[model samples]
Target: MGNLSVGKADSIPTRPKRPLKPILSDAKNVPRRRIGKSHKGRIALLHAIAHIELNAIDLAWDLIARFSNPSLPNDFYSDWLEVAVDEARHFTLVSKRLSELNTAYGDFAAHDGLWEAAIDTKDNLVSRLAIIPLVMEARGLDVTPGMISKFRAVKDYRSADILDIIYSEEIKHVKVGYSWFMFACASMGLEPKNTWQECLKKFYKGNLKPPFNIKARNLADLPQSWYI
Candidate 1:
């Protein structure tokens, strides 16, 4: 993970070098494994989530460094710095779990889909916020419950508990994204909903799959009208 100090936000490079440990592959090429009760299956699932958290750590710092503006408040930097700390913690937890399972993060290949959003929205702060936290991380709130239940059903309480923490904290992460996105919209004199829709259309390649966790989204202050 990158440095979590907000004081160094401006000094950090816009696009840092990618980690070389886990080999990256296309999403289509990455094999899909069901998170069944098998130990190996659990490892794969946790590894994938670790990869996401790792990328999230990078994304948060990149946002602070790449888009730091004199007009934006200090709260913006502190908010993303908090997110970076959370992501680093999440990755460390998952990596520890993987270690307990006799494996580690780089033991398996991971897809680079998460970072693609960053690459696509590199030039626009509003678009970056719209896509990464609002769209990408919000999707986590939608799907995490089912994942937690799966782990619980399989009697993997440790993993389930970890996911539960992630699920709860992720609501705040999405809210941070929403708040900042709205702030940026107001600053730029753009309509929030329309700008978000446009960014999704231009930058996001996938559809907004249903079965959304409306309750969680609501907790994050993300209106259903924006997505549905």
Candidate 2:
């Protein structure tokens, strides 16, 4: 597991536990963000984002452990490991912010959809890359600036600053996914854009809500045509 060049799907845990709070539940059951208007709502929003980061950490590692492609370059593992580190940092930053608000993670209910996305795409690396990074994390690009603004609007500059950092780093994470997805597509002789569309049609369970961050997505090398 320590060696990036060596990988075995069976060697890693199928599900790893973390110290997340408030217990996992259905997505519909989790509180919606009215994060700017009230203290408790803000706490709920942070808790939810923390839960997301924690799952993201697991997702990065899980991608490494679940994929057994011998043709995958060593840098694939390194990239995901870097993503895992970023997610861990994100979790710690958000958790610390939560504590500053006299709250903690697991103090609010969180949805399990992210892990479900992982499970659904586990059998295919292309689909995994499409759904998790392209669709899901890309959604982050769409929404995060507004979250930053919301935090700033309420004068929660500390929280806004943390989100600013996360937002910037996540673009690189998406680029890593985009690069690897293209690699896998080329290896299989499949057109990258078409295969991406096919994967999204097959495995993605939701629509991409609009008002997209075209600039951010472009920065990540994901063109507007991919989403629209």
Candidate 3:
């Protein structure tokens, strides 16, 4: 539902009773900023990451709610719940950083690209796992190091430290997704690699950009052979 909230005290629903929509501009319409050494540029960078962390919080909850199935093991729910908590923490940290910069999450327009990917695979958990974690979150592993370096270069050690925490935890999140996606594929009598490739071709519209973080991805159990 439009008013759904996954607060700490909120109960997880069996499934969404109606369509849920979030208010955000399209990706193309959102303004892009060059994350330079300027204060405003740093604000813009942190603001964008905060927006992503906020969306990640919703995404973890949505995955649990939208695809609730009694047949699945309890570990599935537990994994996603942990992911939701991590996302919330990430959002809080980013928000604090933004506040320190004299800005906030909604101070700039943000694109709903992450949630759009969720919508694309809402009906299929396999596709959802493939696109969200393998493609999107894995991409985070690729780029987050550069973002950390950017902050450190500007001597914004506080922001860089926050990003360091996120970068480490995100690997575990991707591992959760990869593990469950393989589980789903096995349950369906499908080949994991081929099925993942098929899901990308069918549901995802973007390419897997390279210079990938092969080491981090491998640590997460996502081998380059699957995507590259």
- Winning candidate number (TM-score): 2
lDDT of 2 at 192: 85
The weakest ten consecutive residues by lDDT in model 3 span 14-23
Supply the global lDDT for candidate 1.
Answer: 0.88
- How close to the true structure is residue 144 of candidate 2, measured as C-alpha lDDT? 96
lDDT of 1 by residue, 1-228 (tens): 244333434355545576676788876655464677789778888989999999999999899888877677888988999999999999999999989889998888898888877888888899999999999999999999999999999999999999999899999999999999999999999999999999999999979999999999999999899999
Better of 2 and 3 by TM-score: 2
Best by lDDT: 1
What TM-score does prediction 1 earn? Answer: 0.93
- Alpha-carbon TM-score of each model against the true structure: 0.93, 0.94, 0.89
Preferred candidate (TM-score higher): 1 or 2: 2
lDDT of 3 by residue, 1-228 (tens): 233333232454433332232236776655565567788878877877887888788888888877777677777778899999999999999999989888777877777778778888887889999999988999999999998998899899999999999999999999999999999999989899999999989988868899999999999999778988
lDDT of 2 by residue, 1-228 (tens): 356357476666656776656677887889877866578778888888999899999999888878856778888888998999999999999999999999888787888888888888888888999889999999999999999999999998999999999999999999999998998888888898888899888888767789999999999999788778
Ranking by lDDT: 1, 2, 3
Off by over 4 Å in 3: 1-23
Model 3 CA lDDT for position 5: 39
